[model samples]
Target: MTTFLTFTILGLVLGAVYAIAASGLVLTYNTSGIFNFAHGAQAMLGTFLYWQLTYGWGLPMWLSLIIVVGVVGPAMGAALHALIMKGLRDTADVTKIVVTVAILLGMLFLSQWIWHPEDARIMEMFFGAGAKVEFSGVVIRYHEIICLLAAAAIAVGLRVLFTRSRVGVVMRGAVDDPDLLRRCGHNPDRIAMLSWALGSTLAVLAGVLITPVGGGALEANALTLLVIDAFAAAMFGRLRSIPRTFAGAMVLGLAATYVAAYFPTDWTWAGNLRVSLPMIILFVVLIVLPQDRLRGAAIRTRERYRAPTVRKAVTSGAALVAGVFLLALLMDDTSITTFGLGMTFAIIALSLTVLTGYAGELNLAPLSFGAVATIVAFHFGITGTGLAARLTPWGVLLAVLVTAVVGGLVALPALRLRGLYLALATMAFGVFLSNMVLRDTTEHTLFGVTFSLFPNGTLIVPPLQVGPLDLRDGRTLLMTATVLFALIAIGLVALRNSGYGRRLAAMKDSPAASAMLGQNLVKLKFGVFMLSAAIAGLGGVLMASAGGSVAGDNFHIMASLSLVMLTVVGGIGYVSGALFGGLMSGVGFTIIIGTFNDLAAATPPMETIFKSLGHLAMVATALIGMGVGKNPSGMVHDLFESYRALRNARPVLIGGAAAQAVLYVLALTGVIGNWWFAVLTACLVMMLPVFGRMLAPTAVRETPLELVGVDEPYTPELRDRLDRELGLAPALGGDRHAVA
Candidate 1:
């Protein structure tokens, strides 16, 4: 009983901190209509800042706390709001979500560059060498108590502010309708800024308070991930209510703490459960909650867009393939071989494009599925006893099919959910698979024999020799894999241009309308998810073949996030975009790291700057891609169009191709040895789609919202009329549209 009480007390203290963290999330979501994925990072930054001021700068702890918890936190929030969130206010929820992700990435990289927590700066600053406090029979620590007290104080303050303050009223009003608040001569932007500031301050406070208890070895990126639990709390609060958010946080914290205390001894599975408890809770809440109550009404008007012309899409695709082949041939060196890996990633990104861009679903677990498939394939390939080894090519085919089925099964719950809930469920699935399933290290024995699977066997089709070339060599194999997958991916893209693809577009534009038009939402969604998963599985199989092994490290949650980031950066809407994204993310990383290593060897001083600049550029590119609406389909499609236009002008095409050849040669040679050359190459590649003058004009034209009949002035009456016509339901307390 005493142990239980002690555990319970600890749970409560942790719960208080979670409650505080969640309240900030709720505040931001309510005010800005954004689920800021970067909230955790903001909290981590605060913790780091507090540590720096107090320990590094030799400031008084109290003063350090005030500056960190008061000034820096709010200022950071304000800057984030003004610079990123404000501009993205009118963007899609998914876009807004990605923007926060970008911020998180940027902040994480920045923190790594500045602090390098591995060097012990963070620990020295926050933990203070030796500090502890004992209280009651439980022997409570001072830091835990401080965290609890801070959380409680913040909760009470928020309650009073929301209930009594004019600013709070304005914030609430903005949460409901920024346009309405603007019409009333109030600046919603100011309210948003204030909310961001307050929310960030609260987040930072939570970070500072929790750091001592949690540990000071927190990297900004890893630490920020704690916000996932906070998200669970906010979700439980319906993302709109403060009290509920606090309650949700307390529940998560207590659950986590109690679980930790019990410490499951059953196969180390308990650790997984403890870490995933919040995600599980989030998934459950999302699955059970009413979508209408949880999410606001559709913020932006949907556009009715036409598919790209078959001729144009095909021609552009052909050209892209030819270009890649030529590049592969010309750069037949290690870099080119590395570029093949990029092609594989491009395939994965294309899979994401299908799910997110075409189907309008934010599926975060695709990479998890990829990892699973890869591991499974690697196991089969190495063991040589399973159905896979016995059947050879048939086994590989079966593996792909099974992976698709698993993906579909996982996606079953998603049919009934949408928006943030769906996102949470998928993300949880990824974490669960990684932490619980994949992370399991128990060696399995089949038929009374323990089998080791990885880095010891040849699993791919044996090499083939043709004329003067060995097509089965590693380099050739990679090229073959790239070509095969590229073709398969492009074939899937062609499928998207068919009837099924049209149906998906319909579903994305309007679920009700699609249903009215006799589309099966459940079946369609499931099919697309399965198809996307299958493609990802194929990519994974290829990845395993390339790596010649499968370790759990390859499929970390961060890798999953990287895949998403790559897709967003590459453009999420087109097949070509996925290819571009994969190349940039995978091969691009290798290229940059390799280039940096070489440059660092020469100058050493520029190494730090190069590393920092490289990451910064990646984050900036992703943000710019998302912010500027240069999404996969948007950019790739435009580029193809421009390229086609230029194709008609042979002189321009010749001139541009010749210039690109020269630049590529110069960069590849030692003539341009600086990192700037690589950076310029990346930028030029990325910007090709943006500037159409150098490329061929595409026959497929993207229809802006205005051209899609969504620009008709938005008024209450117009909104009502559209709602009635589309059979769309209003959010919260509003008149339900009567069926015609």
Candidate 2:
């Protein structure tokens, strides 16, 4: 009983912080109708900023806290709202989601640039130096108590404010019907800004309070993991009630602590269960939540494509292939190898384009499928213990097929899930695959002997000496793998553009309408899922074959996330976008980093500028997508269209050279980076035009207000009601026009 009591107390302490985080998330979502994916990063930023002010700048802790939580935190939220959310208010949920993701990425890179946590020694200076506390035979800490008290105070305060205050009533009204509130004369944008500020402030408080307990080795990426539990809490509350959200957080905390304590290390399943508890909570909430509450009500417009002329398509394709070939021939062996890897990523991105771009499903676990494929290939190609090695090609074939089938089966749950829920589920699965499955070090034994699946081997193929050039045997094998996969991926793309693709598109645009029109949404979704998985599996096979070894690090959750980011940033739906994203990201590991290193050495200022610009670029890209009310592809497609038109026009007198002027400005501002990075960045920016087109609403003359239920024009009475509902004072005559 004493032990249980001690554990329970500890859990409560930790639970308090999680509760605060969840409340902030719920508050923001309720007001803005957006699940701020960057919330964790924002919290991390606050934590880091607090450290900078208090320790680095020699400010008092209290003063630092005030500045960070009171001023900077709220300012960041307001700026984010004004710059990104405001523009995205009328856009699709997916675009808003990607925008948040972009913000998260940008913040991550920015934090890394400003202070590389890997090299920082602030964790000990700020958090770990604290002393411990003891109560009733249980050891606790001062920081934990502080965290608990702060969280409790915030939760209680919020509860009272919402239930007992007039402002709360107005906020609730705005949440329920922003349009109706707008009619009453409140500026919804102002309300949203306030909510964002309040929520972000709370998030900062939670981060600062929790950091002392956990120690402050916080980075934007690392801290984001804590938000997973917060998300589970919000889901448990159905993202509605504040009290419920707190309760949910408490439950998760207690469950995690107790499970971790009781579970024996001897049992492998125990470890898996312990790590998987939050995801289990998430999955359960997602599965049990009412469909109406879960399904986002965003209408997506169908893409209108103008077919490229055959001559143009042929010329473009030939030129691209020839350039790649020429680069391969002229470049060093390392560059050639890097290019091959880029091609492999391109295959993976192509798979994403098919699922996310064409089908409009946010399948974020393609890397998991790749990991599975890698394992299967390793087992077949090298392991000599079982039937796997004896039947190498057959085993490989079976692995790809089985992975595809499993991928489709996994996606079955997503057919009923949408938006954030779907994204969370996929992310959870990816985490599970990375942490539990791939990271498990246990060896499989046959006949009392443990087998190593990644045993070294070499394949030698006699190369034909063509003219004066003799390609190495390994290069030939890699090239063969690349060409085979490329062909297969291209074939799949063609298939996607056919009747089957149209069916998937129709289902994505309107499942109900598609079902009414005799389309089998279930079958279509399943087929696409399987196809995507197979393509991913094939890419994995190529990746492993290229490296000649299979390692768990190759398919980390971060890798999966990077794949998703690249796919979105490149262009979700277009084939060209996928190809572009693959090349850019894949080449980054080699060419981009190498170029940055060179530039950093040449100019000391270039290092800081490059890092800052990279971070800012990510944020700006995401914001641009949201601001334009489209995905990355929309921007890319538009640029290409513009460029094509420019190329076709007769040469005119260069009066101002507007395009050249813009390039010169970009170069002068130092945002362009190295020549290669600049070119890649430009290509990525260009592809954004076609990115979110399929997910955006149709092009209409009127705005969202006119298209929605609002019929009357804006009036003073309407404005007053809006103000009242959004927690603002009504105009003098507006209060008199209340319906009651």
Top-TM-score candidate index: 1
Candidate 1 lDDT trough over 10 residues, lowest sum: 455-464
Q: What is the C-alpha lDDT of each candidate?
A: 0.69, 0.67
lDDT of 1 by residue, 1-740 (tens): 66887788777876787788888888888888877777888888878777787778889888988898879998999998887777765455456666676677667766765776676654432345345455465566566666677777888888888889887888888878888999999999999999999889888877776665566466665577776567888888798788888888888888987888877576456886887788888888887777762232355532122355557566766777676665554454566556656666676776787888888778776677777566565555333433332223544566678889988887887677776667778887887776666655555577998754333322332222334544334567556656665576567567768889878877776677788778898998899889888888877766655554456656666666666766665457766667766777667666766766676677887987777666666556546543533242345554555555544556654555676777767756757643555566666655554454444454344334243445443445555555554558753334422221
Q: Write the per-residue lDDT of candidate 2 for residues 1-740, one digit (tens) a residue.
A: 76887889777876888888888888888888888878888888888889888878888877998899999989989998887786665544456677776677667666766777676544432334446667777776666767778888887898887889866766766667888988988878888888889989988887777666555566666576665557888887777888888888899888977986887777655676766777778777788777653222254342333223335444555556654664454445766766777777778777787787777677666778877776776555443443222225555576688789878877887678766777777777777676567656655577998854333322211222233433233455446545654565456556665789778777666666777888777788788889889888877766665554456667766566656666665567666666766766566545645755666777886886765555555455444434434443454565565444333222321311444446545655666643644475455445433333322324232223222326656666556556654558656664545432
Clash count, one per candidate: 17, 33
Give the candidate number with the greatest lDDT. Answer: 1
Q: Tell me how candidate 1 scores on lDDT.
A: 0.69
TM-score of each: 0.84, 0.79
